[model samples]
Target: MSDLRTRPTTKRPPTGDLAAEGRRRRASIAAFYTVLIVVAIIYIYPFVIQAGTSFKTDGDSTYNPLNPFPSLFTLDAYATLADVDFPLWFRNSVIVTAFVTVGRVLLCSAAGYALSRLHFVGRKFLLAAILAVMAVPGVVLLIPKFLILNQLGMYNTFSAMIIPLLWDATGIFIMKQYFDTIPPAVEEAARIDGAGVVRRFWSIMLPMAGPALVTLTVFAFQGSWNEFTHFIVARSSAETNTLTTGVAALTTGQFGSGNRYPLKLAAALIMTIPVALVYFVFQRKLVRGQGGGAVKG
Candidate 1:
């Protein structure tokens, strides 16, 4: 009888190249990290400068634009922000962003799920229309959007601010693409169990879509939070000013103040905080979305 543990004479493992392969892999990893660190610094340096400059005086910011540390830290910039209509602008921005993000997430996910799973009439046409709308350049829509808003009698109102952006084409597209990648077995099983459309999506599909939902949440939050273009064209009233519109008004027309760099920088820094928080919280998911073969239009 042959020994059970003995290998066949013709079957030999290759061992010599394993050590060389290990060394090659280690070298590649080191090079990759070196490049990553350099790229990270390039991306992060501007925010560092912006944060430091916000704490400096106007004169200090202009003189030491590249400095990552303030010569003499001061709260004068913040104080000036408090003196204006900043609080109101901040509140309006918060309200609009919250409504828009929630609306987009719910609407886009529903539409995406229906489009991906349901075999209804006009589905192909609806998808084609969405893709076509997504291709339309945003800059060219400025006047058209304003005209429609005026016609709808939503001009200068919160409805005007929120309605146009409630269900974004990009969000719908992202969700549809994500839903398409999911295997249909789960939903089929739910259907076999006599679960309805809502039940299947709510209990099975949406739970499995955790990563995509988190990604969508982050996108919606960032897009609505930092939105400036639509806000500018949608409303002209001082009462309707968001942080972006308000800051722009402050920065451009006040030439008598010798630039007001510190104040401007402070406003920018403050506005950036929400986006930074969202990014830090969901950075891992974002990396996965970009790296794990997720497609974006």
Candidate 2:
């Protein structure tokens, strides 16, 4: 045993000199951080410019397009927003976003659970249909959606804006993928304890879907909040205008010409606040990036 231990068990040290290897390590780290910083600045600089322009006068904004600092910071642009339909648009967005988020939370999870767990007729067909719908581009459905909304007499109303978006194929897909990862034994245990389908799903499964639920909530809120083309065909009245449609109107000279950079940018800047907050709060879940309770197969 002593002779075996004395015999060299460890491999010889790598042939490269320590100093040279250390230099290479330092250089690689420097290169990686350099790339990271550049990418971060590329994303962050546009927002800086937007914020700067939002505080500037029209002339100053035009003259200093790339500058992210105003000559003299002012709230004039925000004040001008008060004079327009910005508040009304903001209110409509809040209402639509709240309703859509809640609806998607319940419906998407339920559908996902059903698709992933329940054994029922037409289940395969239904899942196939959802996948096919996801494969199609969203723009292709605009006219069909418009026609359906108009036919159902939901056009030009809040229902037009909210109902069609309450559940989506993508949300269903995410939830299903998550639910599939959950152990069948868990649900079976609940069943043996006299839990019904609804009981098991509601009391056992739903609570465990935290990551996925957070993910879906963020997507649904952001999608409905920023939805533009659908809202365009869904409603025509100013009363029904959400931030996306209302802000688009501002961009198209509805609020007058000559860039109006401050007003336009301020509106865009304010509208992004809620989405950013949601992202910040749930970013960890976003990173774990799965809604299924755990990753174990």
- Native-to-model Cα distance after best TM-score fit, residue 37 in candidate 1, in Å: 3.0
The TM-scores, one per candidate, come to: 0.85, 0.92
lDDT of 1 at 85: 87
Colliding residue pairs in candidate 2: 212-291
Cα lDDT tens digits for candidate 1, 144-176:
999999998999999999988888888888888
- The candidate 1 region of ten consecutive residues with least summed lDDT is 288-297
Q: What TM-score number comes out for model 1?
A: 0.85
lDDT of each: 0.86, 0.89
Clashing pairs in 1: none
Query: Each model's number of backbone clashes?
Result: 0, 1
lDDT of 2: 0.89
Model 2 stretches with alpha carbons more than 4 Å out = 1-6, 9-16, 289-297
